[model samples]
Target: MITSELLEKYTAVKKTFSKNETIFEEGNLPLYYYQIISGEIKMSNYNDDGREFIQGIFYKDQSFGEPPLFLNQKYPANAIAVEDSEIYMLPKANFMKLLEENPSISVKIIENLAQRLYYKSVMAAEMSTQEPEHRVLKLIDYGITHFDFKKDQNGYLINFTRQQIGDLTGLRVETVIRTIKALEKKGKLKIINRKVYR
Candidate 1:
């Protein structure tokens, strides 16, 4: 993501959102490049039954919803604030201009987008064929590599909630709960004081 000062220079505006607020809905035309300054954001789609299928969770310093902006298409999923959050939004024209003026930044953006595509591909495969344990472990491994997970006495702390994990992995919450307990029994994870560590 672009630095705050640089983004500010490019006319990016900072905005705040309450927890659970919808930043943009699915199918809306993308007009801005969004980068989180604090807290979390999730991109998701809901089925007819209103069960959310999470596409990705993004944290501070991470960018979200860029694909649609780059492709000049409508968003495929909704972006929502996972907590009270601050974000920087740069108009599409300015964002494009910034990229053109800064090749290094453009390269970084491409790399970030590629990483997301890679994650989606991996998760899609896991959801289709992998066992529950395998899918859960794969997500934890990916988060360790890509996301900013906190570390504690036991190991890297898994910050995702059971419901969030279910949403992301296309599993039911009950299944996620059962899977985590099974993983703990197998020495794959630890559940200490209701928190999960890996």
Candidate 2:
């Protein structure tokens, strides 16, 4: 991610959204480079039956929906604020100019994109062949590494809710709950004070 100092130079506007607000919807044309300054955002899509599948969750200091910007295509999923949030929006032209002027930032962006691609590949394989428990654990582990989740004396605490876990793992919420309890019993994770840690 680019530092705030560098981002400030190119930021076109600062925008705020309320919880559950859609920042952008699927099939929208890419226009801005969005970087979160506070709160959480999820890139997701809903099935025909209205079940949500989260492509990714992003927090403060992270950027989302960049692939479409670079590819000159429409957004593949919706970005919604999970809570009231502030974000920096850089015009697409300005974002490209910034990347051209800053090679290091461009390299960092490429690395971040590659990491996302790797995560998607791994999750795709897991969803197709892995059991619920395995899929859940893989999702948590990926979040810990990719999202910079922190550890305490107990373990690395995962911040996602059960519903979010289900969405990310392509499982039903009931299944996610059962799988998590099973994981706890198997010593794979701990649910301390109702929060999952691993």
Candidate 3:
């Protein structure tokens, strides 16, 4: 991600978004390069039945919705704030210029995008072929590596809620709950005071 000082130099504006606010809607033009300052954001799409599938979750210092920006295409999913968040939004033109002037930052951006692609590819295969336990554990492990979930004496604390897990894994919330319980019984996971640890 671009550093805060660099972003500011490129005219990136830090703006606040309330929980549940849409940063950009599905099919909208990609006008800005968005990087979170604090809080969470989700890119998601809903089915006709109103069931949502979360494309990805992003946290502080992470950039989201860049593939479309690089391609000059419309957003494929809606970007919504999971909580009241402050984010740096640089106009697409300036963002491109900043990248051109900073090769190291550009390399970081490429690596970040590659990691996301790898996660999606792995998740796609798991959703199509793996069992629920496998899917959940894979996600947790990826979170530890890519999302930087913290480790403690117990284990790595899982930051995702059951609903978020369900959406990410293409499972029902009931299924996620049942799967977690089954995992606990099998020594694959632990739920401590209602928070999941892996």
Candidate structures ordered by TM-score, highest first = 1, 3, 2
lDDT, candidate 1, equals: 0.95
C-alpha lDDT score of every prediction, in listed order: 0.95, 0.94, 0.95
TM-score of 1: 0.98
Q: lDDT tens string, model 3, 8-110?
A: 9999999999999999999999999999999999999999999999999999999999999999999999999999999999999999999899999999999
lDDT of 3 at 35: 97
Candidate 2 residue runs with Cα over 4 Å from true position: none
Which pairs clash (backbone N, Cα, C closer than 3 Å) in model 3? none
User: Residues 96-126, candidate 2, lDDT per residue (tens digit)?
Assistant: 9999999988999999899899999999999
Better model by lDDT: candidate 2 vs candidate 3: 3
TM-score, candidate 3, is 0.98
- Span of 10 residues, lowest total lDDT, candidate 1: 144-153
By how many angstroms RMSD does model 2 differ from the true structure?
Answer: 1.0
Q: Would you list the rank order by lDDT, best first?
A: 3, 1, 2
Q: Return whichever of 1 and 2 wins on lDDT.
A: 1
Stretches of model 1 off by over 4 angstroms after superposition: none
